[model samples]
Target: MKKFLTLLLAVLMIASMASCAGGEGGKFELGLVTDLGTIDDKSFNQGAWEGLVQYATEKNVSHKYYQPTEQSDDAYLTGIDLAVKGGAKVIVTPGYLFEVPIFIAQDKYPDVNFILIDGEPHNADYSTYSTSANAVGILYAEDQAGFLAGYAAVKDGYRSLGFVGGMAVPAVVRYGYGFIQGAEYAGGELGLAAGDLDIKYHYTGGFAATPEAQALAASWYNDGTEVIFACGGAVGNSVMAAAEQAGAKVIGVDVDQSSESATVITSAMKGLKASVYSVITDYYAGSFPGGRTLVFEAKNNGVGLPMDSSQFRSFSQSDYDAVYAKLAGGEIPRMTELDEKGSPSVVPVEISTVTEVA
Candidate 1:
């Protein structure tokens, strides 16, 4: 009888441990909802997940990620529901695509905390904007990152440059504008006439790596565009393919894309991993800055070029450091204000040749 009682007690203890491991009674603390991509996208999704995984692994907490079934409001909402149902206390949503879904989720999951990266919560039609006490919005200074790419490309002796953007969205526009500004600044430093350095700029209207984008980029390379800055998500892949064929260089975007293609010289990166990590740390420390929107910029080490793998012969790390300091110290003007048409008002170079390819 004594042996049977001891065995029964061991079984009960094992069952309790299993219940906790199964996420019963809210055992999971961290959750991530991927935005329109897989966790290994090597872009936005990967960057954010690296942060979440790093934090959770360090703290030895329970965490999981949910990928939406499709790219729609209902699909993303269902993902959030699943994450919350799995006992997630804090959720992180990556990308601007999650804006509307998160807007709804803030109220639906009132008890759960949310960290929305790259955008704020907004209505479907953008008629209303709100960030509840349970949510925090995060944005990055894409212009600064773009500026570094342009500067590095020009300094590396690339006279003719091209920019292939995904769309004329605010983030893409800022990158384009800053790239042009940096090219003009470098042209002045090199004493090159404005006409001597030409820039071909176009928006691809979508983010997919379509053959159309590849053909467009190939045509630009054939027309003597030395290096093209691919500023979109998968659009960079298209540009890289064309660059490889044309024996030309390419500038990557969003993350360190040097590993993606040999044609890529460097990438303009945002502090996605760092920013997400900081937010998670804050949430755990009970200092989550909820009910507010946060912007990451050069002043906060938020934007720059990846120099470790950059193939620049003339642009040394010290040169980059000097320029970064100027930008960070506010010596160089930031392109923050936009015009009525949502374009940067001040472009130092003549962009009369910029064509919007359909």
Candidate 2:
């Protein structure tokens, strides 16, 4: 009788502990739904995943990521459904592509907290927009990141440059415009003559690393373009391949790619990992900023360049900090992806000839 009582008590204790560790419904308390790319793409997905992994490992929490079978609204929603079914209390979705799916999923899974990066929730037509109490939207100052890359490049003596963006998406547009602006700012400091700088800009129409992107990058390098800002997702891989062949320099985007290639001088990084981690911290602390759009900018360490790893011959860490201070203080002009006319336009610089390629 005594043994039976002891065994029963032990079993109850074990069950209670299991229930406590298993989270709300399943095993994972945190979840991530990748956007159109694998987690190892070393871009948006990877950056967000790193943040989740860092937090989960530290707190001994269980986390998982779901990859959609296709890039579609339905597919992304299905991924979200899987995460919710797996007992995720908070789900992280990277990129603006998840805007509509999250918009729908927020209502469908009102109990699940969502961390939507780079966009806010909106309907398919974008006429109606709302973020439920369970979701928080995240946007980065991509322009600031791009500006650092361009400023450093010109200061390091790169006279000719190129920008090959994946698509004319808002984020990409912002980076492109900022890169041009940063170069012009540096040129003004250097008192460079007008037309001494040439910039070739093009959009690949897609984010995939097509052979065409590589060929175009190679052409730019051959035509005297010194460094190219690869602002697209996998499109950076195409540009890196071209740089390897031409022995030219390249600037990476989204995350640090200095380790990915020898030709990569620096990267325009969205503080993806930091932003995601901070939000997850808030979610677990019962202070998640639901229905709020959090903008990460230089003022908040949302964007920057990996100066320690950057291969700049002239640009130093002090130079980076000085410019970064101006940015954080809002000395630079406010960069917007679209002008008041709702069209993409570059505030042209007289020193550089920007040839926009179709």
Candidate 3:
């Protein structure tokens, strides 16, 4: 009888330890790695993090996140491995910064599932790193969202605008190109003359939050550009600051920044939260969108203008309704794929030639 009691106690202790180590009664654990930033940058990283948080809360699952201290590749992998070692069944990487590390992690821990946002790990030979079959990639139709914002800017009577970009990547260029197209389309539809509104563009070549963005934006504001569109990760915050200080309007990116950038006009938002939330929920259901590259467009509610209170509080209901109808009716075309290798493709909506500067 004493021997039986001892075995039973041992079993109970083991079960308790497992439960304590894992989140939510031993249910599958989820984890996220941010890209050289925190989880609350009010931007891309934040949007992805929010989605996971909401899903975990709703599903009563276990999850955690770790931001890198040194903000290097080694630091990123260490944070990711920390979660994996802690028994995370599914790990999420927030940005393209993790392209290389995720590729390595997938091979190192074949049993773990990975969700990579905004990037895929591929070698020069077009061969993906030897990764498990459990990894998935999530991308957005950012060009389309940028198009909508540009169209709305013109419709709202802001012709001369400025574009501030974080990096000269595909995503940033997509937003830039789409905005130009939307403005051109609006000018034609509104019967406005060409060259009525001039657009000045600049790229900071970095994603970190910096005062340099504000300084760049200030120069444009001084040059009479009344509205600005900023797409840098942390650099965007500086743009918003300049807009607020100069009493000019700004457009935000990734998530809705109307609330975060309250002094700004609106944001060209990707449904990052929804995408993140969907991945986590799928994992719980054993139907994660693994081994696939998921592309979300405006048609999928994956991209749109901001409706957050900070953005729309002062906007009349009719203004919101009008802009929304235009987007929904396909009168607005958001650019998705651009042919330009490192820059945004310039389709002449108005000007025949466009010069890119960084």
TM-score of 1: 0.89
Cα lDDT of candidate 3 equals 0.76
Clash count, candidate 3? 1
What are the per-residue Cα lDDT tens digits for candidate 1 across 62-100? 899999999999999999988988889899999998999
Cα lDDT of all candidates, in order?
0.87, 0.91, 0.76
User: Positional deviation of 105 in candidate 2, in angstroms?
Assistant: 1.1
For 1-358, candidate 2 gives per-residue lDDT tens digits of 9999999999999999887556445567899999987889888899999999999999999999999999999999999988998889999999899999999999999899999999999999999889999999999988888888888999999999999998788888888888988898899989999997888888898889889999999999999999999988888999999999999999999899999899999999999999999999998898999999999999999999998888999899999999999999999976774653212344668888888887
Candidate 3, residues 25-94: lDDT per residue as tens digits? Answer: 3433878878866888777778888998898888787778877777667888898877787678888888
Instruction: Give lDDT: candidate 2, residue 111.
Output: 96
Q: Judging by TM-score against the true structure, name the best candidate.
A: 2
Poorly placed runs, candidate 2 (over 4 Å): 1-26, 337-345
Model 3 misplaced stretches (Cα beyond 4 Å): 1-28, 124-132, 209-211, 308-345, 351-358
Better of 2 and 3 by lDDT: 2
Q: Positional deviation of 319 in candidate 2, in angstroms?
A: 0.2
Q: For each candidate, give its TM-score against the true structure.
A: 0.89, 0.90, 0.82
- Between candidates 1 and 2, which one is better according to TM-score? 2
Give the number of colliding residue pairs in candidate 1: 0
